[model samples]
Structure formats: C-alpha cells, structure tokens
Target: MRFDQELIASMVAPNSRVLDIGCGDGSLIGHLSQEKGCDAQGLELDMKAVTQSVAHGLPVMHGDADAMLADYPDDTFDYVVLQRTLQAVEHPRDVLRHMLRIGRSALVSFPNFGHWRLRWHLLRTGRMPMTSVWPTPWYETANIHPCTIYDFFALCEEDGYEVCRWMVVNGNRQSRLAGCSPHLANLFGEQGLFLLRRRTR
Candidate 1:
C-alpha cells in the first residue's frame, strides 16, 4: 500500500464501515478489509478501474462523486474517504457536503499546493511546479481546484465543519512532527490529510 493509504487505514476503527471515493484499483479498500477488518466498498469514475477492482474480488461501483453520493442515506457509513482526488472533482464543496452528510466522519487527503518546493519552483522557474506528489504538468493534469492546507481549513471553518484531526506529510507521505504545525506544514509539507465532521449546531 502507499504511505497515505497506510495512514488512512490506521485512522479507521476496526470493523467499521468505510466508503472510498475515487478508489483506483481498490488497493486501499482491500487492505482495509484484510488488515482492519472493516466492511469496505469503493466508487470509481473510471470503468476500467471498476472492472479491475471487481476482478480482484473487491466491491466497487462505477459512479461519479458529485451525483452518486446523494443516493446514500445520511450516516450510512462510519467513514467516507476522498483521497488524492479532491482537486479533480467537478464540485468539491457539494461532494464534501454529501460526504459529511452520509458518513459519521470524512477523511480527505490531497497534495498541498502551498508547499515550499512548489512555491520555490513557481517563483524561480515561473512555471507550474511538478514534484513526486504532483507529477503532472498543468496542461494534462486532472487537478482543476488545487488548494493549500490553510485554504482547506478555511473552507471547513466556513462550512461549519469541525476538524477532528489533521496531519501533514512529506513528499514520501510520511507524517512528521514539524509538519504538524499549521504554519510550518503549509510551507514545508507536501501533502495533507484531514479527518472532519459536521459540527453540531
């Protein structure tokens, strides 16, 4: 499993329900099922990925995050996850709203656009930065709404969502203490993962 997948799986409670959005090839879902003993399923936009996942004996459906989430009843899963695909979604805010509504908690992981390397590259080279985590060039990239860690937190605040826990990781996706600080993480961390829920009004 990838480093982010390991961290995400660690956050999940054993034997709980999990729904993984944009689950490419179903590796994480399979890992969660075998290692964490969780009931896991996936929704993938790519039909090829869906087919591959099913052939591997994983339960994954062909669906889009923007539309399919509304079909699920509220509180349907213990955790709903959107990993590395938030920036690629058509309507991120709406997708997040539905995620938090249908699950007790939501786990999100995304590349941090505010990382020092990205900023430095942009400032020095005067072009979009490409790194190990964000390897795509701007023209062919799927990311339409890349955001910073601070930006994501601000959105959570504005939407009345409570950040339960958050972590910032290096390019290799290893969580480090220096990356735990909000300011430092925004500057140095390559990616961020957040666990959130709707705040009780």
Candidate 2:
C-alpha cells in the first residue's frame, strides 16, 4: 500500500462505512475492505479505472464527483475520502460541503503547491514546475486549483469545518513533517492529508 493509503487507513474506525470519491483503480477501497473490514465503495470518473476495479472484485462505479455527490442523502456514510483529487475537481469547495453532508467525516489529501522545491523551481525556471507528484506538463496536468496547506486551512476555517487531524508528509523521504505550523509544513512537505468534519453550532 502507498504510504498515504496507510496513513488514511489508520484514521478510519474498524467496520465503518467508507466512500472513496475519485478512487483510482479502487486500490484504497480494496485495501480498506481487506485490512480494516470496512464496507468501502468507490466512484471513479474514468471508465477504464472503474472497469479495472470491478474486475478486481471491488465495488466501484462510474461517476463524477462534482455531480454525483448531490444525489446521496445526508449522513449516508461514516467517512468520505477524496484523496489527491481535490485540486482536480471542478468545484472543490462545493464538493467538500457535499462530502461532509453525506458522511460523518471526510478525508482529503492533495499535493502541496507551496513546497520549497516547487517554489524554487518556478522561481528559477519562470514556468510551471513538474515534480514527482505533478509529473505532467502544465497543459497536460489535471490540477486546476492547486493550493498550499495554508490555503486549505484557511478555506476550512472560512467554511466552518472542523479539522479533526492533519499531516504533511514528504513522499520521497517517507517522513511526516510537523503540522503545528502550516507555513513550515507547506514549505517542506510534498503532500498533505486532512481529516475533517462539520462544526456543530
């Protein structure tokens, strides 16, 4: 399993329901089912991924995150996961709102746009930086709303979402950075993972 997947799995409660949006090949969902004994399902926009996941005996369906989430009733799941797909979604804020409404909590992960390496690369090259997490050229990349860890935290605060837990990890080093300071983590970490829930009034 990927390090992020392992981290995400650790946060989930055993035997709880999970819905993975934008799940690629259903690997996380499969792992969660086998290791955590959770009733996990997935929704993928790519039909090819959906087919491959179903062939592997995983419960995955073809759907778009932006459109399909609205159909689910309130509190239909224990956890809704949107790993590494936040920047690619059409409307990230709306999707997050729907996810929190449909599930008790949401797990979101995304590449950190404010990493020092990326900043340095852009500063030096005067163009979009392509790192391991973001390998494609600017035009070919799916990320339309790349954001820093600080940006994400601000968004959560503005929307009144409670951040239950969050971590910033160096994918290459396989080390987790201190998340107490978003500025420091955003400058060092390559990726970020967050567990969030709607704040009660």
Candidate 3:
C-alpha cells in the first residue's frame, strides 16, 4: 500500500462502516474487511470489477456514483470514499456534497493531472500526456475532467467543505516536518488524499 492507501485506511476506525465509490476490484474493501474488520460496501460502474468484488465475497453494487449517492440515507456510514474517481464523474462537487451528507466524512483522491511533468510534456512536445501515472491515449482515457492539487482545495473551500487532513504522497511521506519548497511539493506530490468534513459555519 502507498501513502494514499495508508491515509485512506487511517481515516476509518476499526469496525467502522464504509462505502467506497468506484471501488476497482474491491482491493481496499477486502483489506479493510479482513484486516481491520471494517463493515465495507462498494459501488462500482464496471461489470468486471463488480463481479470480481462479488466473487471475493464483498458487498458490491454495480451502479453510477452520481445516481447512487441519493439512494443512501444521511449518516449511513462513517466514511465515504471517492478514491481516484472524481475526474470520471460528471458532477464531482455535487457528489462530494451528497457524500458528506450521507456519511460522517468523505475521502477524495485523484491523480493530479497538473503535475509538472505533465505540464512539461504539454509545453515541450505539444502532445497529450502519456505517462506511467496516466497511461492512456487521449481518445481512450476514461478521465473526462482532469485536475490539479490546489484545484481540489479551492473547490472544497468554495463548497463549504472542511479539510480535516491533506496528504500528498510521493512514495510514503512519514515526515513531521514540511517545507515551502514549491517545486518539490508540486513536482513530487503526484497523488493526494483529502479528508473532508461538512463545514458547520
């Protein structure tokens, strides 16, 4: 597991209920159930992923995240996770708002398309990025909308969502100290996990 995985895992208490949106192949859900004893359920759009989840004895529903968010009642789960899925959906902000309403907290993680390497590729080669992180031809990529690290925070601020914790993972960032090295944070913070709560104000 990477730092994002550790951050996501740390968000939920032991035996806490969780609902994972766009849960690919039920990997984390399986881990949470077997290792942490979490009560986990998953919502996935892909048939192959859903079938794989079911075969693993995981509670999974093949459904759209945008539509399915309205089905769950308020405060149904301790945590609602949107792992690497915000870009794929039509209305990410609406989804996040509803997720917070339906669960105590929400975790959102996305591949940062605004990484400097991606920027360099676009600027230098004038070609759509085809890297290890986002390995897809422009026409075939499932990513409808791409985003940056600060962009996500800006949305959270605009929509009155409180950021409980934000972890920018290069490999496994375990340091207590941080720096204002703008180049390092931007260039290296490839993936991030943002833990959010409803803003009371």
lDDT of each: 0.91, 0.91, 0.82
Model 2 TM-score on a 0 to 1 scale: 0.95
The clash count for each model shown is 0, 0, 0
Measured on C-alpha atoms, candidate 2 has an lDDT of 0.91
lDDT of 1 by residue, 1-201 (tens): 788888899999999999999999899999999988999999999999999999999999999898899999999999999999999998999999999999989999998999888999999999999998788999999998999999998999999899998998775657676465888879887889999988997
Using all chains and alpha carbons, the TM-scores for the candidates as numbered come to 0.95, 0.95, 0.89
Residue pairs whose backbone atoms clash in candidate 3: none
The sequence of per-residue lDDT tens digits that candidate 3 reaches over residues 87-150 is 8898887889889999988988887776788989999999999887788899999888788877
Instruction: Give the range where candidate 1 is weakest over 10 consecutive residues by summed lDDT.
Output: 171-180
Clashes of 2: 0
Q: Is candidate 2 or candidate 3 better by TM-score?
A: 2
Q: C-alpha displacement of 103 in model 2, angstroms?
A: 0.8
How far is 135's C-alpha from truth in model 3 (Å)? 1.1
Model 2, range 87-149, lDDT digits (tens) per residue? 999999999999999999999999999999999999999999999988999898899989999
